[model samples]
Target: MTTTKPRPTGSSGSADDADATYEHHLTADEQKWIDKKKYAWIFSIVPAAIPLIIWGVAEWMKAIDAPVFFAHASWFLGPIAVFILIPIGDFVLGRDGENAPEEFVPQLEETKYYRIVSYLYFPVMLASLILCCWQWKYGGMEWYDKLGLAWSMGMTSGIGIVAAHELGHKKTGFERWLAKIVLAVPAYGHFYVEHNKGHHVKVATPEDPVSSRMGENAYTYLLRSIPRQIPRAWNVEKTRLARSKKGQFNLDNDVWNAWLITIVLWVALVIGFGIGILPYMVIQAVIGIALLEFVNYLEHYGLLRQKLEDGRYERCSPEHSWNSDNLTTNIFLYQLQRHSDHHANPTRRYQSLRSDVFAPELPAGYATMIAAAAMPPVWFAIMDRRLMQYYNYDIERANLHPSKAAKLRKKWNRVAAKQQQTVKAG
Candidate 1:
């Protein structure tokens, strides 16, 4: 809804130059808007409290010792809420296509309300995680139920990391340290190192492991991305310390600090709650990291930036990311689905992120799509067609793994042949 002219190809000039030129083209008249909407921004903080809500319900269920239905399935209450209810709610409530007026963008971005919510996100998340750990040790649930509870805790905590992401992009040291603190919840401190330093530079290209290429399934992508990213983060941090003439082992190494914090958290939980808490913590952490990976898979799956004549990939643009403006999901996820804008202006606050019409649209909210991604056939059937259509059936335009290139080409040819045959029959 924030209408702007199409940007020139990334190869035409530097990315900063493109952004500056784009800003310069806007006229004074188009920048003014009388209406200011601040009430809706409050809903963005709801995700920070989801863990507490889930914990409250779980406690209630235990108090009642509810029937088998609630007792057995209560552990999965968070996932069911997010993946099932949220998607359904999105479809029912529908999307808001309005973008904040241009002049109002700065005012929204500068709000202390947004910053305060982000800052408080950490303590709430930390409290919920401790509560979950306590419940796991003493709740006397079956292994199945315990696993479910741990997973729910993990999933909700993973959303907390989304708050961490918003803070991590800030230029201030306080926000960045908060990012590192929140990341320790999932033992994913490396995310701070890799995502900003590594993924941003190479995203939507084959060089980035986090970016799922055409024909790659989510399962395969998860396995590849999670392992590779840790070392990638470490290496990135190592390089940074070297440039600063600092030792890799020092506090200046953020990766080391995050890892130390993670180790301390785990050790404290184990000492406080006994060895049983260890599995719960580890499983929950794994699930939390997996949730992040699942999102990474969906955000840029099968999209690619073009290579220039000099072999450097074109700078990323809105077209390189799949976006959803689905209102309910966007509110819960902190406008993460407006990912095109986030990548284009990495430091922009979530409340001010605009939906770009030029970005490729997702069929549904991320929660619905994440569920679909679990079924590889369904994911392929939906996304593969979208990918082919986006590239006009030209495989060269797609970022495909070499092993799948020939098979995808053959598949494309078959689709083309079917279309031709249908035309002849007509």
Candidate 2:
């Protein structure tokens, strides 16, 4: 319900001023809807900022001769915030149902302020990573503190990837390259190619390894998704190169080149710090990539796009993607919780992404759901029932694990049939 004046199109320093022209056409009510989440998007930087704040606290604690345990505990505030505090914020702040109408998208998209908010994350995140590395090498910190720092960096890098996701989806070459650059922090630069080329195209279908299968646990998912995504991304670039008769051995291959950035970054950090810094880097990369996968797993779990008579999978609709509108997660993630609209318009700016209330909605925002996904029994206990209801107990419609398909189909199809019979009798 909060409101602000409708910013003149291109007034916020958008580069393409000619396209938008210096004008405002929206009525007062429409302007209010557009501005509701405008400032909220700035919170996307909080994840990237957490490490720097933690570093400052640790430094302050040291200066004060604070208890060693208190100093060490500060390192864990990053994970505590991501996994614990953010979820609580979702419950407390509740859902955001605003969807700026289609007429407003062009002006909303041209608002450069939103992009600038995301643009801040990279430098802040890199500074945080560098500081964390320095502490690991030169601060004489204990092993537990280093371990905590690694997880903290991982959590930040994981959120950095979310910013990268926003950047990667833009039509501009600059944003795309920024996505690759940010992804290098977690050694996950391949995500740039695979996510845009592979996952988006194959999402919610059986062929997509990145899209979690109905019965797959997060632990097993790491084995399935990680091994497959790298090669798939490579192949996508390779196929593109092949069309022009260029081989993948050269730097023209995006996957190899992007990874080279990762190699150079890690090597530079190792050379500057000690070789001992390598293990913490590895730890952060593992946890960072795991965090990214956890989000991927829940985004499209159990949703299957039906195949047409022509044998092509039906186009991905809102029905195929899970949506959540918890205000806290929405703001921190650039409204990524409004995922159905994202899949529909992949290159749409985050501030303009719409909510589809009728789409299959996650029971809670991704912050809470990802924690549930980490525990298989908990994930299934929460999501399976909702997924069944989405498909109206027709397990045949779900994107199920091959191993569990028969058993699930037998049980759920019977329930569906019983419901049909009861409806007929009524």
Top model number, lDDT: 2
Question: What TM-score, to 2 decimals, does candidate 1 have?
Answer: 0.89
TM-score list, all predictions: 0.89, 0.91
Could you tell me which residue pairs clash in candidate 1? Answer: none
> How do the residues 1-426 of candidate 2 rate in per-residue lDDT, one tens digit apiece?
232332221112333332343344566787555377777777889898887888888889989999978988998888998999999999999998877866778888998898899899999899998998899988888899889889999999998899999999888988888888899999999999999999999998999998888888888878988999989999999999999999987788889988998889889988899799999999988889888889988998988877989999966777778889999999898888888889878999998888875578898989899988988999998988899888778787889999888887887888888999999999
Over 122-203, each residue of candidate 1 has an lDDT whose tens digit, in order, gives: 8877777777777788877788877887788787678877888889998999999899888888888989889999999999
lDDT of 1 at 97: 73
Reference-based lDDT, residue 128, model 1: 74
Worst 10 residues of 2 by lDDT: 6-15
Model 2 regions more than 4 Å off: 1-28, 31-33, 63-65, 421-426
lDDT of 1 at 336: 90
